[model samples]
Target: MILSLLGRLGRLWIVPVALAVWELAAREARAVYFPPPSGIALHVYELWFSGPPARLFLTDDAVAHILPSLGRLLLGWSAACLLGVVAGVALGRSARLSQYLSPLIHFARSLPPPVLLPVFLVLVGVGTPLQLAGIVFGVVWPVLINSIDGARYIDRQYLDTAQVFGLSRRERLTRVILPAAAPKIFAGLRLSVALALIMMIISELLGSTEGVGYRLLIAQSQLDILTMWAATLLLGVLGILFNAAFLAVERRVLGWHRAAL
Candidate 1:
């Protein structure tokens, strides 16, 4: 039991050790741009998380900015994934459709989504719609390509077996194709989460008010170095949490797949 506990603690020791090193280096350097993690943490707390206990200690700014940003991120990623999966599945199942559309997909994906921010702005105007479109455009390609690949490369044996069983089209898809393609689909989804966060920030960078990205832009404009670093730290932590959550879900959903392998 002690050994197991030690093993768990051992894995996490590097985090504290790294922070200690950073703290010492930043103190020694006395750089305005590079504040210690402790200070950054406190600053972020004071800025966003210092509300009444009833509200889970989240300040107004936290509610105003963080929530909207999170909402946008979730909505955008979800929309993109849903669209990608549906379209990808249809295209994968249809050779002619894929043949006609593959070139267009590649060309559209080749154009940087950030560059098209202006186009989106012109089309959709500013605010949530614009941000959502940007994120969808940027992150959808991975999911689409992976979904298509997953659907296209499914084993013939599985299809034959399904046909023998007389499974309906929906049943074949839900039971066979999706299960087989889940790993690739999940890979794309995981990658898109990171891209979603990036695009979330990028979308907010050039546009209107509110969001974590806007906070960063504000800090930079005001030369609030500490706030900037704190915001950065918060973003890093959020990224870690997002990735961790995705991994947990993937492990749970694909546990059988892993065991089979």
Candidate 2:
């Protein structure tokens, strides 16, 4: 029991240790660019959470930046999830279709999303639509590919058993295929979520008037390194929180799979 506790505490020690090293280095160097983590934390709090908790801890400026970015992120990510799952399942179940579509899929996925920013700007103009389009295009591929692989490789016995049990097509899909492929699907989802955040920032950085990304860009332009660092930190925290929340959901949904394994 003591050893287990020690191991858990030891794992958490790295964070504080790293922060101590960073603070020492930043103070010693007296570099304007490398603000200490403590200063960044304060900047983040002042910029975003200076308001009362009753008001959601967001000032108007924070709201303007955060909500729009989150909106784009959520819309794009949700669309990708829905489309990827549907398309992946369809292609996975049909080997012939997968073969026929392979080349097109490869071509589409190979196009780096950032490189298409100019085209999207022209196609959709500089607005939420452009940002959203870029995000969907970039983030969908991982989930789609993983879903395809997962569904394609489902054990033959499972499918055969579903058939033997006289399950309907929908029943077989929900009861057998989705559950079997869920682990991989969730894995892809995690990747897609991260990609969604990246694309969101890139899209905002290239164009548009609002969002955390835009704020980050403006801070950099103004040489407010602390604010830039704060935004970067905020982004990192958002990613961590998103992943952790998704993991909790995944554990709940796939509890049976864990038992089976």
Candidate 3:
């Protein structure tokens, strides 16, 4: 127990040590653009415990900004996951359909979503839909491609066995194919989550009334370095939280695969 506790403590110490080094470096360089760790921490505390009026969290405004970004991320990512998995599964199950759609899928995936933000803005206007579209467009390809690859890689012997049992297509897919392809689907989801978060921030940065990115922009305009650092720290925390939550869900869902890993 003592050794385990010490090990954990040692691991946790790395972050502070790195931050200290960064703080010293920033101080030495006298770089106004790069705030030291202590300065950023002070900003983080202020944002978390007290903020000026008109921000989301009057007491803890960080939560307000964080929640909106998270909401956008979840909405867009959830839609992508649903559509990507369904389409990928169908395409994987049907070689003819896959061939027919391959060119179009490739073309769409090849295009950068950032470049199309203006087009989306024109079509959908600067609203939730446009933001969601950007997030979905940025993230959907990974899920779709990974799902298709997962489905296609299922063993031929398993298919033969299912055929011999006279299982219906739906039964075969639900009982066998989906279970086998779950890992790949999860991988896609993990990748998409990160991408979705990035897109959410990008969308907000482009034109948003509220959100961490918008707050960061505001801080920049006002030359409020502390607030800017606070926003950045909030973003970093959000990213860590998002990743941790996804990892927890993945572990819960794929517990059986742990042994394989």
Candidate 4:
């Protein structure tokens, strides 16, 4: 147990070491734009965690900036996953439909998402709707393409066995096809989550009034380097927490697959 704990701490040693180095360097340099890590940490706490413990320990600033971004992230990711998986499965199952849509899908995926931001702004206006559009557009392709590939390439024997067992279409899909495709689906989900977070921040950076990205932009505009770093640190922490939670869910859902492997 002690060795396991030490191993974990050893693995994470770089983080603290890097922070300590930065702190020392910044103190020695005394540059106005490059505040020490301690300053950044203090600012982050004051800006986000100064509230009472009962309210999730979130300050008003945290509520305003963090909550909205998180909400948008969830909404966009859920929508993208639902639409992507459904469309991907349909396309994969229908060769004719896949062939028909191939050109359009390739074309759409080729375009970078930032290019669509202006179009979204014009069509959806500047706010949550626009942000959701950007996030969905940017992140959907990975899940859709991964799901398509997974479903299309299933073992022929599985289908033969399902047919021999007289399984209905729904039963075959739920039990055989989806189960086989679970690993690929989880891979796409992980990629989509990261992309969703990135797109959410990008969407907030432009034509938005409230969000973590917006606050970071404000700090930059006001030349508050310490606050900017604090906001950035907060973003990094949020990403880490999100990924950890996502991994936990993935482990639970894919436990059978892991055991099989």
Query: What TM-score, computed on C-alpha atoms, does each candidate reach?
Result: 0.96, 0.93, 0.88, 0.95
What lDDT tens digits, residue by residue, belong to model 3 across residues 30-116? 898898888888777776656655764455465667667778888889999999999898888778989898899888888876887
lDDT of each: 0.91, 0.92, 0.85, 0.90
For residue 146, give model 1's deviation from the true position in Å. 0.5
Per-residue error for 249 in candidate 3, Å, reads: 2.3
| lDDT-sorted candidate list, best first | 2, 1, 4, 3
Q: Which residue window of length 10 is worst by lDDT in model 3?
A: 51-60
How much lDDT does candidate 3 score? 0.85
C-alpha positional error of residue 213 in candidate 1 after TM-score superposition, expressed in Å: 0.5
Error of 3 at 30 (Å): 4.9
Candidate 1 colliding pairs: none
Cα lDDT tens digits, model 1, 1-261, are 999999999999988999999999999999878888889989999999999999999999899888999999999999999999989888888888999999999998788778888998899887889889999999999999889998899889999999999999999999999999898899889989999998988899878588888898999999999888877888888899999999999999999989999
Q: Which parts of model 4 are misplaced by more than 4 Å? A: none
Clashing pairs in 4: none
lDDT digits (tens) for residues 117-207 of candidate 2: 8999999998899889999999888889899998999999999999999999999999999988999998899888888988999999999
Residue 48, model 3, lDDT: 68
TM-score of candidate 2 to 2 decimals: 0.93
Residue-level lDDT tens digits of model 4 in 71-167? 9999999999988998988888888999999889888878887889889999988899989999999988888888888889999999999999999
